[model samples]
Target: MINTSTMVAPWWQQAQLGIFVHWTPASVPGWAPPYDPAGRAHLGWTSYGEWYENSLRFPGSPVSAHHRETYGSRPYTEFGGDFADALSGWDPAEWARRFRAAGARYAVLVTKHHDGYCLWPSEVRNPHRPGWHTPRDVVGEFAEAVRAEGLRFGVYYSGGLDWTFQPRPIATAADTVAAVPRGAYPAYADAQLRELIRRYHPDILWNDIAWPAGRAAIRNLVEYYRFTVPHGVVNDRLYPYTPLWRALRLPGLRAAYNSWERRTVVSDEGFVPKKPPYYDFRTPEYSHYTGPDPFEITRGVDHSFGYNRNSGDDSFIGRDALAALLGTVRSDGGNLLLNVGPRGEDATIPPEQQRRLDWLGEAAGVGSAP
Candidate 1:
């Protein structure tokens, strides 16, 4: 729980469009189920490249099937090495330039996803899984590049789910909530966030999943808002941990998280008792509703947020649609945080995603190339 008394909206609230970069080893295989078996894939369950590790854990999920067929009985840990090697060819400067050209006011890179693979050179060790972090300083390099382009830099850390920290297979929403690590996981997230704040001082601290419910988590969130980060913003997902998700009421997790059951409500963006504020801004993923809330609608042009080699030819937005999406978001008094999952091998934005971004830049009168 951050000390909300000191919290204020960062420039991002009005700056509008921010680009979310979800590049991990998952980009290596680049596949997700495309649709949520539970329901309402559009609101939340489209595609997420960061879930590669978890996908591999399931015995029958598409990701698991794909992994077995492609990699064959190999452990998922091998992809960490592969992903690190792929980092050698990454071009941060070019990425920053293109992000600027895409009219991004801020950029959030996934410093660590549920896989427990850290992008930056973190001294924090994964006690659950040894040798799980990267030796390269991806966060520092990328942050510097983005800031140099005048775009505010942000970090997305998965405090709720870490497959390496909790390696059980999960097939349902309840199973998903049950598997989140608690013991030392919160400490790990705290240390990494402190490291990110001390080193990069990211403008946004985007957390996915609720934070571990404990003293340390509260302390860290308070310290982050009070001291380490200035002008920093947090997302709605930073909630006190609820073991077994009592907050979501047993089996209503999907419904609470924006299934058709709760249409107007944004999932997991609940207020505390009678607390007035929800967040500095609201986050509605994969939809373009003309709402009145101060919000940021994040969605991938394709079905998945990460690069999906298997996303099929029709799974992307064209230049016209991209421009229209931006227009709708802006006209609705909301920000559009578009997402791009770069190929891990070359750290390149797929041509389809980039083409639309180029058009968005031109439409916003930011770039001439489109």
Candidate 2:
């Protein structure tokens, strides 16, 4: 087993609040169907604006219709250029200040999302899309700013799904599993992650979905990470796929697994993976887990983790609700990693999101570092 015992209780455990930043090319369009709490969990109709490119692949989906009407014949790749242009106005220091003022003890930025756009000018270039990464050193600037403000910094990378490698539209849980690209992807992800660790030395390594490589590779990476950053923590989503998981992709099994996954979400159980070789804490998205293990409850202030144009005041977590959530999570010995999805065009945190952060700052006393 991976020797997590060597490290003391991680800093994240005591950090009751962290800010999650999700800025991407998808933020340029920045639209998603209005989230319906009572509706079924359909991938195509997902409320996450960050999934715009994937959602566009589904014919007749709202995003597809929106894209066609808004930016006819313009490929999703073009958004990368638009996003780069928008960076001219982005101020990472201001972002760090906002996060610090919100009483965040730590801040985790999505360095790479599913769409395969790198926020920093990464040395590991995308093979399919040349120079797909941002010209701005977003990751470096943000990391520096956050640390300067005395808050721990972390990076979020989508290790399992890089649409540039597979470009598959995932509608089902099985489809998600199958979409984990094989071939050069495993090494590519590994190198990028190592680079993040080498450059940032982040306090938390927050990975999403699953690692495309199997258990051994993930274990090795975790070992290397702990060795490099002794106090750093890794979340549970790095669990690797097994032969049994691969079997879920079979047509007959795919439908069954998909049905079960949807049911789990509807029932509010969410999809927590079986324990991997090792993890410092569990991460549950838009779900709650009150078991014995340490976990972080991550969700957008609104229903979507990315800025959704459809999200209004009604869609946001109210001040009272947010306070209750914080109380409950703290009582259960968990942390809350609340997300902020800034408007891509101007890098402005929406007033709705800013108001909630302001409330939190006032309630918790701003500028108090954990």
Candidate 3:
């Protein structure tokens, strides 16, 4: 919905490499499977981390049953408010330094996850008031740090998928819908988002878990380009307005987002089903725990990039693997986005991960180390 006239940089020339950081208050305890009474693993908890609320639509699933039992059938706010101060030792500068050293052209940090906890102060709803409210403006500091290192800054917002804010789905017609109209919330969400834009001036808006009823919210966000960032790029996954506008036609649509990037995983079903044309860019994000050969981004290294607390082994892509992967993508004139899930509150990248990523940068002949 952003005005087409505001674009400054040609979409075809967007950065070829991006680093996605997925940190949530839930990540404080690290990645763990949700428990169930019958001892069967829950489907919702298994796929994604921290975004459990978005997947709780199934009626009799473990997440639903477990949530109802623990929180007395209330909304997700109850559990969201239960976050602890696990990251008293967070240092944003260290993280920025490492990311820059890793040759990341841009970085996406989690501003507000599905749990409804805002890393920076939010005026809209004190969703995580007593638990993790901070006056420090964490996201602002991240933007400053990232920009200082000369990398593009971005924020990953989950406003559309806040279980604490919109506990039940739009299909659930209840009094809650009247109290919180999805239509009006776009302005509130925009207000909160504007605070970040005012501070960070991010180049990209990475949104997650887009819903049907929340279309206006993102459209309003695009409209913001008229006043604020005229050249800002928004991911279609944010609110499903359209696939990222791109140039080179992959299997998907080649219209709006002229530079497209697909975040997929190695699966038994062959990298999961997607629309045709496959498109301009596709970055397969292998999780912490996956197979050896299939998980490898290239033919060389065997590793996983997504966060894994227990993964002490260098299961992620190594320098050789990274170089080869980037080389392959570059040969085709596409981009690569490596993801790292930082510890909650502890904003710095883990020391071990940093060392390996540094090695990758060195091996790939990218990024100057600070």
Predicted candidate 2 versus true structure: per-residue lDDT over 250-305, tens digit per residue: 89999988888676543352455546677878777778885567888988998888
Preferred candidate (TM-score higher): 1 or 3? 1
Ranking by lDDT: 2, 1, 3
C-alpha RMSD for every candidate:
4.3, 2.3, 9.8
lDDT (CA) per prediction:
0.72, 0.86, 0.51
Q: Please report the TM-score between candidate 1 and the true structure.
A: 0.85
Question: What are the TM-scores, per candidate, against the unseen true structure?
Answer: 0.85, 0.94, 0.65
- Return the lDDT, model 1, position 268: 34
Q: Candidate 1, overall lDDT?
A: 0.72
Residue by residue across 128-225, what tens digits does model 3's lDDT show?
24444445577888888888888888787765555555654322111112223254455556676777777777787655544323455455565674
Error at 271, model 1, angstroms: 16
Number of clashing pairs per prediction, in order = 0, 0, 22
lDDT of model 3, residue 296: 14
What is the alpha-carbon lDDT of model 2 when measured against the actual structure? 0.86
Q: Residue 215, candidate 2: how far off, in angstroms?
A: 1.1
Model 2 worst lDDT run, 10 consecutive residues:
1-10
